[model samples]
Target: CPALGDVFCIAQCYRAEKSRTRRHLAEYTHVDAECPFISYDDLLDRIEDLIVDVVDRVLKHREAHLLDEVNPTFKQPKKPFKRMNYSDGVEWLKAHGIKNEETGKFYEFGEDIPELPGRKLSDKSSKLVILMLPPIISPTPGINTSTLMIREVIFDRCEKKERILPIR
Candidate 1:
């Protein structure tokens, strides 16, 4: 471990941009963690372990019954979330016939996918793990392992709700 070790902070973060959706908030609590001297695989494992531990704790808590009321099908998502690179994800989208409503062409690399809820499989609960980001859009050039994107959408009472812990 480096001198700093792994540091975590729950700080209040604000987004200046205006957004009407519930997913995009103006002010929200941010949990930030920085792990130094660790391999990319180690970081991913740490995240998966944390998620599993948290879910186990939550299910064991006194108010866990409330979760059942909200969603009886809620279960611990399987381990080692599915990993999908950017280009591959785009291909999946194209194959599924999901594309930009305005543009009839498939999304090219380096172009941010505006929204993709159909990425979820009907029977499986899997989150996307983008391993290699495109260089054209990556803020950190030449650094391939600095980012981990796990994006998913959940429908609550027929409402589209996104579930992604902002971790980078």
Candidate 2:
């Protein structure tokens, strides 16, 4: 079960962080701060890679059943596995009114949706999309432990909303 609210919150946080980073870069450029020697392209590339890694770790953790048990609420029952094609998932999101701002498409799941070609992970098939949180501080500490804990938190949040709303 995936809680939509939590997922949405994580997505928002990721976007905000990205925005802040870009703003900081612009400020540094103006002030000529010795903000390292990384090029803008390099920074962007690193961010992309970091996002992918986080998503992968979260997905694996969820798949391993490491999440906490969620309290049953007004959640809808999980749907059976459908083995849908990648395009199908995108279409489904579009049908459900989820739009991607980048491609002007509706399949984007922010940090949760991986860059998979097809076969979108969905709660319908007991497949969850995990989005890892960025490191708390520079030189993030306890990478493994923190990631696992975050995964558990995300899992519990999602489980609570497994079937709360109908998917289009």
Candidate 3:
């Protein structure tokens, strides 16, 4: 295995196709990071820390004036973001009466949560949302991998919650 560390990049990007999630943009600055050899929890912790640090710093030195003028009520998210598995998220959505636009039915496992439903879920839940797939035990020998093939749903207070939908 190769040495592992986190790498980050910021760039102006655009996709040919449209995306429903607010996190996506036709033209936006993308903040990306990659880290190998870390557990999902560790990665989450790192991401949380980075977001808090960046937001705080930006508000303090960079965009405070603009933010104050435009949206003074905006507040930085608190640390230690919450975690929930996919099944529970689906239950929460169902209990809350969130439904798919096409089917007009409450979301179920294996159904893709489109942008509207995802936004509805976020509007109802806590501020930050993060969905994490637990480590996978490989069926084949000599490798352990957790591809995003599993159908699970998890909702939380952060932007990562969009992934709660299955990859249909």
Winner of 2 and 3 under lDDT: 3
TM-score for every candidate vs. truth? 0.65, 0.22, 0.66
The global Cα lDDT (0 to 1) of model 1 is 0.53
Report the number of the highest-TM-score candidate.
3
Per-residue lDDT of model 1, residues 53-135, tens digit only: 88899989999999889778675754676555455556766777666655877766545555343334222234534333222
Candidates in order have lDDT scores of 0.53, 0.34, 0.58
Ranking by TM-score: 3, 1, 2
Over 36-73, each residue of candidate 3 has an lDDT whose tens digit, in order, gives 56665776787778777977897789547997776676
Clashing pairs in 1: none
Candidate order (lDDT): 3, 1, 2
lDDT of 1 at 80: 74
List residue ranges in candidate 2 displaced over 4 A.
1-80, 101-104, 108-121, 124-168
Model 2, 1-168: lDDT tens digits are 133321211211122234432122322211111224455335334434544565457546745343324322222222232333333455566676665556766554332233332223344445333222322231323323322422223311221111111111
